[model samples]
Target: MPEGPEIRRAGDRISRALVDKEIVKSNFYYVRIKDREEIVKNKNIKEITTRGKAMLIRFKNGWTMYSHNQLYGRWTVNLNTTKIKSTRALRVVFKTKKHTVRLWSATDIDLLPTSEEHEHSFLKKIGPDVLNESCSYKLIEERLTSKTFHKKKASTLMLDQTVFAGLGNYLRSEILFDAKIHPDDRPFDLDKTRITQWAKSIKNISHLAYKTGGFTVSKYIADRNKENGEPRKSYRHAVFMRYQYECLNCKSRIERKWYGKRKLDFCPSCQIQTGKIKPSR
Candidate 1:
């Protein structure tokens, strides 16, 4: 699934390309989009912004278009001078005087109100977005320390969008590994200092992911183009695929295990499994 950074980048692209222009044409693929014709025919795009992993395209008349590109969804922007291929599976198309933007295979494409009440109501249900500039550290700390917090494994909690939006399986593992925290450690068991450190690391990684256009881990390697270098595979396969591969840090054997339904990889010596660190008061 695309994480927060990827969505943010998409918003930036869409906003820059389509914000001021009037929508001359619009089209839809699936019937799931409510009032598709009304939205395309009447609404004028006011702005494009991202909330968590979702993208919102606000219109002048108060309606907003919301989209979440689950896994396969992708967008392509072509200048008016360029040619665009014709395809029936193309979900949503927005044509401007200067450019044409097409969204394909989007899991979500819906029209909604842009009212303050509606926006607040929607945001109220979600936790702080990791990539949002205004995301509060206090809120994150409070959420991490709240009563409902069980000592659930950090890996599992990170994937819970309710705990912190924008994190996926790959980011979860990488962030925990970067902070030198074991994926299996319970949230409450972590000291305040460790929790704060993890939160800051998440912000940094999220920014890096956005800047690199969705390529997270493999972007760090010095030689991404070596003759023997294969594009680092998806996060799951990159980390968990080679069970006996040497750890990049300590040269220890990387290990894998089934944590719930998902596979997780970690260095045994680096990520200590026991949650016995002294709490900072």
Candidate 2:
């Protein structure tokens, strides 16, 4: 699934191609979006930005277009290309004379008045975008210390968009590994200093993911790349997708287990847990 950084990057590309340009044509393949032709036709795109995993296309007339590329959605922007071939469903298209912006396979797309954009059902529920420069560390720390969230497993809390948006399975595992915290550890079990450290890791990894196009390898592994030795693609992450593989730091075998239908990866030695973590494929 595309996370916040990926979505933000896509929005940046689309914005560079279409922002400030009046949409001369618009098309939609999804039934929900087709009826909104009159609403978006000929509207000038004031901005294209992302909030968490959601993409926002704001127009000059106080109307915004929201699109969420859940797990399978993708966007393509083309300039001066006459023909394009795509195997994915061409869900939404916005065209100007010089560029074509397409959202492929996106399941959620809505046109809402600017006054109500904040009140959109999904947008209203999600927390602040972690990739946003203005994302509040204090707010997330408060969430960690909150009575309702304190008892939840750290892994589960990391995946909760309502707590802090834009984290998915891979990022969560990487973040926890970076913090040296077990996925099953309750937030309340961690000291305030440890909670703050984990919070900083979240922001650091989130920024690194944005800057490096989702690479979250440790400095040691990344340094190997600088030494003229290419890190194997299969061993890219410290723990994620490295089930039964040796840990990058301790040499102990990395483990994987199902956490809410999603795989959680970690080194048993690195991520200390209260009880034994049963490993599965």
Best by TM-score: 2
lDDT for residue 123 in candidate 1, whole number 0-100: 51
TM-score of each: 0.84, 0.90
- The residue-by-residue lDDT of candidate 1 on 1-281, one tens digit each, is 77888788888988887887877877666677745657655356889888788788788877777777888888788897897666536878888888888888886777657775246444556677878778766666677777775566787777887788788866776677666778878767777898887777677767777887755456344242222344345332224343566565787887876777877777777778654554579
Per residue, candidate 2 scores C-alpha lDDT tens digits across 1-281 of 98887888898889888898767887767888677767877788898888889998988888888999998999988885768977988888889899988888888888888789889999999877888878767777887889878899988898899988898888888889998889989888877887987888788888887877777875667666446444454345677877777777898988887976899899889898845555568
- Weakest lDDT window of 10 consecutive positions for candidate 1: 222-231
Clashes of 1: 0
Runs in model 1 deviating more than 4 A are 34-36, 40-42, 85-88, 116-124, 215-230, 234-243, 275-281
**For each candidate, what is the lDDT?**
0.71, 0.83
